[model samples]
Target: MASMNDHPGERAAADPVKLIGVRETPLSVDEVFRAVGDDAAGGTVLFVGTVRDHDGGSSVDRLGYSCHPSAEAELRRVAEKVAANHPVRALAAVHRVGDLEIGDLAVVVAVSCPHRAEAFAACRALIDDLKREVPIWKHQTFSDGTEEWVGAC
Candidate 1:
């Protein structure tokens, strides 16, 4: 029987989550895309999330994102989970915090895998799990003098 430690490269291959962050500045799609580039990957998928003009049929005047101190760690956890479930060769994710106008990039995530379907599935799972599990909240001000905080719980 061969010990796993005999192959250090295989050990590193077990954990493919590369980059994870929460930034106060704007998010960059190109940066995230470049971070996940891999020579061994056959497919790379990138997903950019932007602030929209409206939500729930109401005009959004502006919005701000806030997060707990552990948000970055939580994001890493989500990315790791996605990598573990897929054949992820590389992965990167970043979310912006601060006031943002409509059409501003809010989040960027990318994944590279051995196949197109694997890349797509991993990228989708990364973003979806980050949104659902991260301790980030969005405060939206509506045009009609109303405001709401989302994902606060």
Candidate 2:
């Protein structure tokens, strides 16, 4: 198998940030980490948000996500902000939509910087901004047959 170090876009995909749209398929944490993995980067930070079995004491059985077309545009804007604010060598943010079972990955954000402090700061900011700004909604179904539509909750 090809390692993440040998990612196809290593040479040409040199943009400081990358954003992707994928089906409700599984994501590779290692791949996101490696996308920003560079010798010049001293630190890499990543955030993975997973679908949980419960939310606010409600037992969640499954979730469905839908996004506005503007989601992709917003994600790119977030990545751009990170690159501008920090000495980010590379960054990527990916969010999966459609039906998802418990424990499935909902989103992943990764960032690499010249130092650990900057990487951590940038990663945190990216995730926070995304949760607040991204035009995505989650429809959660509970085990008790109750369902709720939450806007980025």
Candidate 3:
């Protein structure tokens, strides 16, 4: 655990969050996988979320993602929490917003740790927290012309 009196820069150096971002452009799995690369890490986990073809028995024609201004900060906070709870050597996460079609990548996250179990747990925590805590919203347009928005808040 980091001491409360520890300098922010020093703490960041000791436990680095390698990459964090919310982008309107397309996301890359290779980029995220590479970002969390660490020489000392024995295990790495990568997760990718994609826009699927259907939802709730309805065919999805397209999907759009939107977010509040504080979304990136919230994502960083989630990453920090995961890092604090695990032996994370490196971590990275990126989410895509704006218009998207079926099969488009929606999110990518990766974590590296000293062991495979730690890495898997940390990566799962990162994604779960981000989805629960962040203000990113998803809008789905069904083939029948119905639209819906989904988010925590």
Candidate 4:
């Protein structure tokens, strides 16, 4: 009998994390979801962060996101944590910088696991940790002719 570590199936289950930075452009939700698609994995969870048109009753016209160099590094670290904590088959995360129109995707996260519960838990944890630990900031441009810089709130 093959040990867990020596088993081919177990070795193939490991998936490395991916992080990417890009200029603000149209994001394909399908692409992100496909990155985590695995035949052995029964569950896949995708999270998309969008630029809402309104914030706290104020109409938001657009948003500008900026990140410290350490931000992308931190995001990679978060993805690594998810892979270590769960049976993650594949993981990918990308964040857009520069100007973005309302309803644009700011970030996309996808995770696949052998079970639905683990997939949901890991997906939620990945996004929650990214929001709290990543150093990305957003400048909200309001329709009232004002702008405010805020953390990934």
Instruction: Estimate TM-scores for all models.
Output: 0.90, 0.85, 0.90, 0.85
Whose TM-score is higher: candidate 1's or candidate 4's?
Answer: 1
Candidate 4 lDDT tens digits, 1-153: 667665343333544574444446677788888777777777888999998999989999888898887877888888898789877878878888888888889889888877788889989998898888888898998999998988855
Candidate 4 residue spans exceeding 4 A from truth: 1-12
> How do the residues 1-153 of candidate 1 rate in per-residue lDDT, one tens digit apiece?
448554432222455777789999888888888888787788899999999989999999999999999999999988888888887889999999989989999999999987799889989999999999999999999999899999998
lDDT for residue 117 in candidate 2, whole number 0-100: 93
Give the RMSD in angstroms, all C-alphas superposed, for model 2. 7.6
What C-alpha lDDT, on a 0 to 100 scale, does residue 32 get in candidate 3? 95
lDDT comparing candidate 2 with the true structure: 0.82
Every model: Cα RMSD to truth: 3.6, 7.6, 4.7, 2.9
Better structure of 2 and 3 per lDDT: 3
Per-residue error (Å), model 2, residue 60: 0.3
> Candidate 2: misplaced stretches above 4 Å?
1-14
lDDT of 2 by residue, 58-104 (tens): 89988999988898888888788868877788898888889988998
Q: Give the per-residue lDDT digits (tens) of candidate 3, residues 1-153.
A: 768975443232375698999999999999999998887788899999999999999999999999999999999999998998888889999999999989999999999987799889989999999999989999999999999889945
Candidate 3 residue spans exceeding 4 A from truth = 1-13
lDDT of 3 at 52: 98
Candidate 3: the clashing residue pairs are none
Best by lDDT: 3
